[model samples]
Target: MLHLKDGLSFKPGLSDLGALASHYTVVFLLLTHTCGGQSDPQPMVAMAGDDVILPCHLETAADASDMTVAWTRPDLSPKFVHVRRDRMDFLINQNPLYQGRTSVFNSKLKRGDLSVKLYRVKLSDGGTYSCFIPDLDKESTVQLVVGQWILRSLDLFNAAF
Candidate 1:
């Protein structure tokens, strides 16, 4: 005897075995379809005051025009850095610290390029950033390392002298 959530109860018999197997197959297919994307975290190095791009893309080629893409820094205030929804960039809820400093490649959105460009990187910008696509339930992390530019310039000057 089996009881389903729909309040359906039935006794299993030899003829009912095929129907049971079919139900299991459908469940397995749905699970695989929903969990098809992959997330890969990458490390990025940048000089202070420089611009950098954080990469995130789907394994298979697919249009992401209708997907909701979000960039967040969990350790920072106003966690959201950049968010795109309904084919438009929404920043009303973005962190004030990141205002006017972040943007996505709009033309590339259709090609599944959810990467975000951050301008004028600061020392405080060195941290882990998460790129999430809610529709696919996929997300990836990117670690940013910001280096002091003045020190590097000084080293280069001394080496050339």
Candidate 2:
């Protein structure tokens, strides 16, 4: 038994699955739209001079150390942030800003862990980063909010002063 406002009600049964699903579909769309469609629960945050891991995963048991993993920032000119290929780091087209500050887990790549670690994070590092596996056509994104906590701390200090 399901009840809705405006005196509407339903006695859902096997035959009424279609109707129930239709109502659920409408509700799902409404909720998502109302939430502004931003599905990421929370953006990753890191302070200046800290290390942060921008997580990406393949969710497979296959070995991927030999596969090419492309980590890029779409807003950057060169775009390619860190790329691994042929069992070695390929930096031919990597962005200069990330030249010596990024790396992956060598031991975990066999399990499809494509996450990258950013060393000594800077405020300029705050942005959307993406990881893509071309051969598998799989990709994921991580939003980094760098130094936000520092900003909040400054705000508190100013208020106290």
Candidate 3:
């Protein structure tokens, strides 16, 4: 004999299953009513010259060695400030203005790394730099900020006085 225990819920018998199924159907229908959809997350945010890392992910297993990866200051004429091609040490097409500076931290391409390092970052470098991964047809950008204040105070005055 099946006994109904106190505070314990039991599955309804086949005869009551129709009612149970209808109850579930009603709940599912209620939840399916949409309110709205979500927006895509912004790709990049700015940081001071403390070295900002632009995040990018690979979508393909194809060779990125011959892919044309470009990083540009988008505010201007889409100037090709930096172009990386092949796995042999990314070539800095060197904007006449960016001379004596700008190096890449790009490591092994097979492992899918495409990071660039800007050295002694200046105020003019405070803009968006986009890295285009053609193999995946994806672009990731990072904003750079330059600050005037030094993090540490000098001890020159104590030595002199």
Candidate 4:
């Protein structure tokens, strides 16, 4: 069983699968802070054929020019979407689908910008992404909402309100 900070617990294997399948998870944030990490809580919305920037930054605004920044989607195999190390892209392990479709603004790295731009968004791209700064021992997440799901989400939101 995995236990969360608020005392919520669940066994993560077989039994949990069906329960998860029956649920519609709206949004969730998990911040593993060893050194303060920050990310915009509002998801970045984009159409299926649009380019989008998933934003993340350090709460302390420390220089990240030479640090290792890893972007990954926990639910994907060979999860790496992008990885920057020593001020250059280290793409040897990037997922094939993301090849030639992601980039970081080198000019902004020095100011603690760890965001990545993803091009030609697809419906499969809708999910939570994890940003890890190994040097700072911090991690944060951002969500990408694609296409028609955005409209359905808004409808659900207004109904609840």
Per-residue lDDT of model 3, residues 1-161, tens digit only = 22243444465578666644443322110001101111233433333344444433344434455565666667755365566766454444556555545544454445455555555555566666666767666776655544443322223312221
Residue pairs in candidate 4 whose N, alpha carbon or C atoms collide under 3 angstroms: none
Worst 10 residues of 3 by lDDT: 27-36
In model 2, what lDDT does residue 71 have? 93
Model 4 spans > 4 angstroms off: 1-40, 148-161
Per-residue lDDT over 1-161 for candidate 2, one digit per residue giving the tens place of the 0 to 100 score? 65544466666578667644433322100000001123554533446777877777776567898899999999998999899999899988999999999999999999878888889887788777888889888777776766533123333322332
- Model 3, residue 7: C-alpha shift (Å): 80
Better of 1 and 3 by TM-score: 1
Best by TM-score: 1
Q: What is the C-alpha local distance difference test score of each model?
A: 0.72, 0.71, 0.48, 0.73
Q: Model 1: which ten-residue window has the lowest total lDDT?
A: 26-35
Better of 3 and 4 by TM-score: 4
**TM-score of predicted structure 2:** 0.66
Top model number, lDDT: 4
Q: Which regions in candidate 2 have their CA more than 4 angstroms from the true location?
A: 1-43, 148-161
Candidate 1 residue runs with Cα over 4 Å from true position: 1-43, 152-161
Query: Which pairs clash in model 3?
Result: none
Question: Model 1 over residues 1-161: C-alpha lDDT tens digits?
Answer: 76654576667787677655444322110000111244333334456777888777776758888889999999988899999999899999999889999999888887888888989977788777888888988887776766662333333322332
What's each prediction's clash count?
A: 0, 0, 0, 0
**Per-candidate TM vs. native?**
0.68, 0.66, 0.51, 0.66
